[model samples]
Target chain A: MLFEQVNNKVVRAHVTAQSPVLARRGAMLGYSGAVAFRPVRGQGGGVGGFVGAAMSGESNPMMASEGDGAVLYGYKGLYVTVIDLDGSYPLTCEADRLLAHDANLQTSVQFVGSGGVRAAVRGAMTGQGLFTTLVHGRGPVALLSHGGAFPLQVTGQWPVGVDPQAYVGHTGNLSLDLKAKVGFRDLTGRGSGEAFTLQVTGQGTVYVQASEQKF
Target chain B: MAGPSVFTAQSLPDGDNVNPYVYSIGLAGEWFISKGAMLAYYGNIRFEAVSRYASVRDFVAAQFASPVYVQDWVVAEGQGKLVIGDRGFDLNAYDLDDGNLTIKASNLLAFDTRLALKQSIVPGFVVLIGTGRFIASSNGPVIFVEPPFRADPEALLGWADCPSPAVHHDAAWMAASFAGALQGALGRTSGEEKQYDFTGTGTVLMQSSEIARADPAVLRLIEDQTRLLTDAQAGSLGQQLMARVQQR
Candidate 1:
C-alpha cells in the first residue's frame, strides 16, 4: 500500500521534501518529522478564485502538506479510498468526499447539476447544489465516505436512477436528469422519503456513499 | 502498480454486494426492496410502489404478505442489476432453502420473489419462507448465538425457528411491589433491567451494538397494538402519550 491505510478511517500519504500532497483543510491529524502546511483556496487560486468556487457550488478548501514527512489526512473518521488516476482519465467527486490528491492534479468545478429555472426549483426542493468538483491529471486521490463509497457500473441500455443525497460522483459519458414520482401515499405523509431522485444515463460508473447526504 | 479498478455494468458482480454497504441484485422478473433503499442501477429496470403494480397482483399477493409496512417497500421489475444501500450499515445476503427466517423489517433490503413473506408475530419483524435469497443490513457484522440466552432488545435483530422470547426484566424491577412496578412501566427505571430471554433450541441473531436506524413504522405498529385497549384504557393511554409528547 504505497498510500498506506493507517487505519480503516485514515490514510497516511507518503511524502518527502520534494513531492508534497494536497489535502482537505482541517484534515491534518498528525505528522512525523518536518511537514510544512499552507492553506490553499479552492480549485482556483486566492480569495477571488475562492469566492467564485463557493458561489458556483464547488467550494472545498484544501491544504498543501509538503516537506520531509508522512502527513495523515483524515476527516471526522470517514473511511478513505485511495484511487490512482491512471491515464489521467479525469475523476469527479463530491466536494465533501474529496480528502486528498497529488498536488499536481488539475482540479476544477463542473456544473453537472440542474440548469436554469428548473434548477432553482429543484435546488430549493432537494437542497442540492449545481456543481461537482472535478480532478484531472491525477496521481493518487483519496475520497472519504461516511460509511464507505461503492461503485455501480452503468451502460447506455439501462439508465441508473440514484438518490440525489446518496450520489457522490460519476465518470464517463453520463447525463443527469432529475426525476420525481409523487404517489398517492406521498400526499398522505405515509410515503417513502424517495419521492425525488436523479436519473443518470450513458456509459459510465456512478459512485455513491452508503449513507444519505444530509443537508 | 495498476490504477484504481474501474467497474462497468458488465463487470459488476451479479446477485451479490459490490461493497459492505451496497448490494447489487441481478433482476429479471421481480424483487421486493425496502423503500428508499435503492442507490442506483443499470440495465432496463423500473421500481414501482409495492401497491401500484396492478399487473403483478397475483404475484404480489403470493410474495408480499405484510400489509402493515406495505408503504415502506417497492417492487423492482424488469431486467438489469439494481443496487441498494441502507443508511451505511453492513449488508449480508442469506439463502433460505425450503427454510424460514424472520428478520427485523428495517434490516431487510431486498429479497427474491420466490420467497413468501409474512408479518412475524413480533410486531416490528417479518418472516420469509420457502427457497430464495435476501439481503439484510446490521449495525455491524451479525453475531449468531444459540438459544437459552438473554439479549438487549435493541441489539436483537431477529431469530430463526425459535419460539419468541419472553420479555424479561430483573426480578427486583418486576417485584417493584405492584405500584412500584406500575410506575416503572410508566417510564422510570434503569434500562439494564430489561432484556429478552430466549429458551428455545435455535439460532439467535444479534447485532454488535444497540444503535439502530429510526423506524418510522413504529407509529403504525403502536397504533395497531392499541386496537386491543378498551375505550377507557385508550383514553388513559392517550393522556399519557400527550403528556410525554408535551414533556419532550
Candidate 2:
C-alpha cells in the first residue's frame, strides 16, 4: 500500500482510481493529481455510519478522496501515529483522535459510561464523551496526540491508574473506573487537580499521550 | 506501521523522557510531584497529600522547605514506573550537581527529595538547592542562551547559577508609544515592551515560544505575601484586589 506514514508526525496517502481514502475534515495540507475531496454521504450510509455519529456524538466531519493521485493528511501539527491492524483485536479510540483509517475498517460508537454510577462517567471530567469510537476490520488506523503516545501493557495482577486528560485509547477487553481521592484541601478550593483518576484493569494495552486536551 | 515501542513497568527508562511530552520515572522510594501532572503508572505507587500525610510529616519537615508549594504538591512513594505529562509541553530533565537553579513554579513537574526547595525572592519562581534531578515542561523545546541577552518574561523557562534578574523596560519604545508614561491608565503599549535583562556568567533557559503556563496558584502566593503589609496597606490592597477581581 502506498498510503503510509511519511514521518512520525505526518501521513502520505497515495490514492488510486480503485483505492480511495477517508480522512478527517480539514486535515488536508496539500495534494496533487486528479483528486476529489467530497463529504462521505451519510458517512458511507450503513449501520455503523450515521448511527455511530448520533449515538456517540462522534462527528466525522469527514471527507473522502478519489482518483489516481496522492494526498497528504495532517492535523493541527500534532504528532501523527499510524497503527497497523491485522484484524486480530479491535482498537478503541477517542472520536477526535481519528486521522485516517483503511476503507475496509468499520467505525462505530461504543458505550463505556457507568451504569448509573456517578463516578464512572468514563472521562467526563477530562472532557471525553461517554461513548468512544471503535475501529475494527482495519488495515491501518492513524492516531493523533500533542506528542506521540506511550503504550503501557496491563495485566490482571496489577491495575493502572491514568490521569483522565492524558488518556488516548486502548485495545483489548479493558474496564475503566473512576478513582477520586478527595482530600481536605478540596473544601478550600486548594485541592490537587489530580484527585480524579481513571483506574484501568483487564488484559490490554492502554495508550496515553503527554499533553492533556484542555476543554 | 509495524508497531511503536511498547513500554512496561520494567522496561520504562528511569528518570528520562519517554517522549517529548511524557516523562518516565523508575521510582522506588519517593518523589515530589506537582499535582495532576502524573499521567499513568504501573506497580503499587500511592500518592499522598503533602499536608495531610502523617507518615511523611518528618520527611516533609526535613526535606520540604517551601511552604508556598505545600498545597500544590504530593509525595508519591512505592515501587514501580510512573509516567507524568504537562499539558502537551516539552518535558526536560535537569541534573543539579551541588548547584542551584530557579524556575517558574508552574513549569516544575517533579523533583528528587535530595534537593531543597526554597521560595525565590522573585515572585512566581522557586529555587532548588543541592544535587538532584528535576523535571520541567516548556511550551516548546528549551533554548539555552548565554548572558547579555534579554528575554521575554513569558518565554523564560529558568536560569542556572545566575543572580536575580531586573526588569528592563524599553524606555525608548515607552516614550515612542506611551509618551514616557510609566504608570498611565491610558498608555497603550505592546506586551513586548518589558523584558528581563540578564548579565554575568550563566546559562538562561527559554522556550521557543511565548506561551505562558497557567498559574492558578499565583493568587494564593500573592495572598500569602500580602500578610507582610501593614493594616492600612492591607485594607487598601484588599480593595484594589476586589476591584481587580470584579474587573476580570
Candidate 3:
C-alpha cells in the first residue's frame, strides 16, 4: 500500500519515482527522505475537471509530492479515513473532503445525478455544490471528516437517508434523491432544521461523518 | 489498519453511540431534537417543527415550554434508527431519573419528550425537568467536579442537583480594574476576571476545552432582558453595541 494511516488524524504516504501522491495543498505536516512538493492546478483532474470545479465554485488546490520517501499529510485536525479501491467502482466525493489520492488514479468531475432542482437546492444548502469529484482506478484515497467517517451500504431493498451536511462521499452505481419535509410552519421560521435529506439508492457505499459541520 | 466498519440498516445500533461524536437513537416513538442535529437515519421517520407538532399533539406544547428555544428544536417521530451529531464535539447521553439538570442551550442536542424544558433564570441555559435521557455535546469529554470551585464560564457544561452558580468576580482584579473604569476605560476585562462560582452541594459538568458554541437563543434572551432597561439606557446600549461592531 502506498498510503497508510499514522493515526485517526494523519496519513503517511510512501512516495517513489514510480508512484507519486497528489494531496490537498497545505496539508503536509511532515516528511522524511528525499520528497519534493509542487503545485498542481485543478487537482490534476485535467481541463474538464477544472472547468467543472470552477463552475461549481468548489475551491480545491492540490500539490504533487515526488521522490523516494514518506510524506505525512493532514488537514485542520480532522479525522482521516483511508478508502481502498479495487477499480470495481468509482468514488464520488466532495472536493473539500478529499485529502490525498494516488497520482495514477483517474480523476474527473460529475454532477450529482438526476433529481435536478431538489438536488441542486440540497447541494446549495449543504454548501457541497452541484458537481462532485470522482476518483477512479485501484488505489487508496484519504478522506477528511470532522469525526472519523464510516461507510453505509445502499442495497436494492433499503435506501439510505443522510443529512446533506454530514455526507462525505459515495461509491458504486447509485441515484440520489433530495427529500424535504418542510411544512407551512417552516415559512414562519418554525421549521425543522433537518428539512432536507439525501436519499441514496442502488448498490453502493455512502460515507457519512459524525458531524454536520462544514469545513 | 482495518477499514471502517460498514453498517447496514439492520446492523446500526439502536439507541447507542456510533462513535464518541455520534449517537444513534432507537426511534420507536418521538424525540425532541435540536434542529440540524441529525446525521442520518433508516426506516420511516418524519420531522415536524415543535410549533407545528404542538398543533397535532398538544402534549408537545406542554413538554417544550421554552419559547426562546422552540424555533431551534424539532419533533422526530416514527420508527427508525436516527443518528445525530453536534459539530464534531464529544456526544454523551445522560439519563435523568426523576431529577433535574440545567445545561447550556447549544450543548443540549436532543432530549426525550417525557422531559419538560423550562427556561433557566441564568441566560443561555435551560433546565430539563422529569425523568428522561438527553444527549449533550461538549468540546471534549465532560468532567465532573464537586462544588466550592470557580469555573471558567466558557468551560462549564452544566450542573445537576445544584443551585445555579453565582457570578463571581476576581476580587484583586476587580479592585485593580475599578480605578481603570473610573478613568473611563470601560470594557477592560482580561477575559478571566469573572467566573461562575459554585458553593453548594451538587456536581458541576465541565468540558476539557473552553470553546463554546454560539447559542441562537442568546439574542432573544438578551432582548427580553432589555425590558429591564430604561429608554435612555436602551439608547446608550444601542450606541455601545454599534461601537463594538465597528471595532470588530
Candidate 4:
C-alpha cells in the first residue's frame, strides 16, 4: 500500500490486496507486496519482524496474511511508481528520525518543523476523512500510520488520541508526551482503559480512530 | 633512629649471559640485585640500624657462637673457602684485612676498637651471626629479626605505610603472570602488538604500548623483595649472604 498528497488539499492512497476485502477508515492491517487482514503487534512484532520474515521466510502473524494485495477505495486511482523488493530502499525523511517502530507495529512518531504545513499533512492522514485527490507543494511532512493506509483530516481544535503503534505519520511540530491513567484505586484496568497514551498537543489537526485501539 | 641503619638482604635473578644463576642481594639505596640475578625483588625496602658495635667482626663472631635467634650455622673450607649461613658469616682469604687477622668490609658492623685485632684459631676463617624481629616497611620488604632489640617496628622498618617487600613481590609476580597469561590467551605472537579485551563484569582492555611502558626496575624490586622474605623465613640465606659478599 502507498499514499501520496496531490493538489495541495487532497490525499491519494493506493492499496493492492489479494482479494476484495472490507476496510474502514481506521482499520488496522498489514502489507507486504499485498495488503491483507492482520493484527499489528508491537516493535517485536510489526515491521521489524516483517523485515526479518521477508528475509528468512519465517512466519509472522503480525503481517497481513498472504494473497492480500492491491486494494483501492473512494475515487483516487494512482499507478504504482516503484515496487521495492531488494530491501535497499532508503526510507529517509526529516520525520523518520523521530519515529520508532515496534514488533506489534505499536510506536510513536514525533512531528517537528518550522511551520504547520508538515503538521497539516500528518493531521490529514490521522484524521478520519476521505482523501479524494493529492495535495501539491505543501512542504516536507512526515506521517506514521498503523496496519493499512487511511485518509483523514482535522477540521478544528479537536485533538485526537492515536495508538502509538498504529500511527503511520503525523505533522512536523506536535509536542508529545506519554499519558498514564490517574488515581491508584482505579489501577485495576477499570478507571483507566489504556495503561499508556501518547499525548500530542498543538493547534493543528490530528486523525485517529476507534479501530486502532489494539496499538 | 640515631644509629646506623640495620640491613636485611634479599636475592635477585641473574640476568642473561651469566651462568650458575648467580644471586644478587639488595641492600639499601640504588643497590640492586645485579641485573644478572634471577628471582629479584621488585619493590622498595628500608634497612634500620638496630645496634652499632666498634668491633663488627667480634660482634658477628659472638653472634655466630651463640646464634641468638639464628636458625642454622655451617663452617666449610677449601676451594669455596666460604662460611655461608643465616647465623654465621664465614670469611674468605681476601675478606681479611692487611693484618691477616681482622675482617674488613667497606660497611662494617663494629662494636669495639680492640676487637678488630682479635683472631680466631679456626684458620683462614670467619663466622658472624645474630637475629632480630621481622618488621614491615610502609612501602617495602618485610624483615624478620629478634623483636626485643627494637623499640618500634615501624621506625625500625623505616616507613609509615609501605607494604612489605614480600607483598610487593607477590603483587609483581601476579601482575607479570597475569600479563603473560593475557598475552597467551589473546593468541598474540612474539614481537606482535598485544591487546587484551576483558569484556565481562570487570573488564580490562590493554594494549602493547601500555605493557611496554611498565618499569622493569619496579618489577624486579618486587620480585627480589618477595624472594628475600620467603628465603629468610625458610632459613635459606643463599641470596642474602651472596648479596653481602658482593657488596663487600
Instruction: Compare the candidates by TM-score and give the number of the best one.
Output: 3
Positional deviation of residue A40's Cα in model 1 after best superposition, in angstroms: 52
Assess candidate 4 and give its TM-score to the true structure.
0.18
Worst lDDT 10-window in candidate 4 chain A? A74-83
lDDT of 2: 0.75
lDDT of 2 by residue, B1-248 (tens): 57898888778888788989999998988899999999999999999987766354586656677777888899998989989999887899999999999999999999988898888887788999999999998765665667765655665668889878788765554454454243332324334446677788898876533345567667778888788999999999889989999999
TM-score of predicted structure 1: 0.52
Candidate 3: segments with Cα more than 4 A from true spot: A1-215, B176-188
Residue-wise C-alpha lDDT for candidate 4, range B74-120, written one tens digit per residue: 21111111111111111111122222221111101222111222222
Identify the runs in model 4 with alpha carbons over 4 angstroms from their true place: A1-157, A163-166, A203-210, A213-215, B1-248
Q: What is the lDDT of residue A16 in candidate 4?
A: 36
Q: Candidate 2, which segments miss by more than 4 Å at Cα? A: A1-215, B54-57, B180-187, B209-211, B228-232
Where is model 3 chain A poorest over a 10-residue stretch in terms of lDDT? A36-45
**lDDT of the structure predicted as candidate 1:** 0.74
- Compared with the true structure, all predictions reach lDDT values of 0.74, 0.75, 0.81, 0.26
Evaluate every candidate with DockQ and list the scores.
Answer: 0.01, 0.02, 0.01, 0.01
I-RMSD for candidate 3: 16.1
Q: List model 4's recovered fraction of native interface contacts, to 2 decimals.
A: 0.00
Better by DockQ, candidate 4 or 3? 3
DockQ of 2: 0.02
| lDDT of each residue in A9-75, candidate 2, tens digit only | 5577888876687777556544546566554422425756666676667656665666777666666
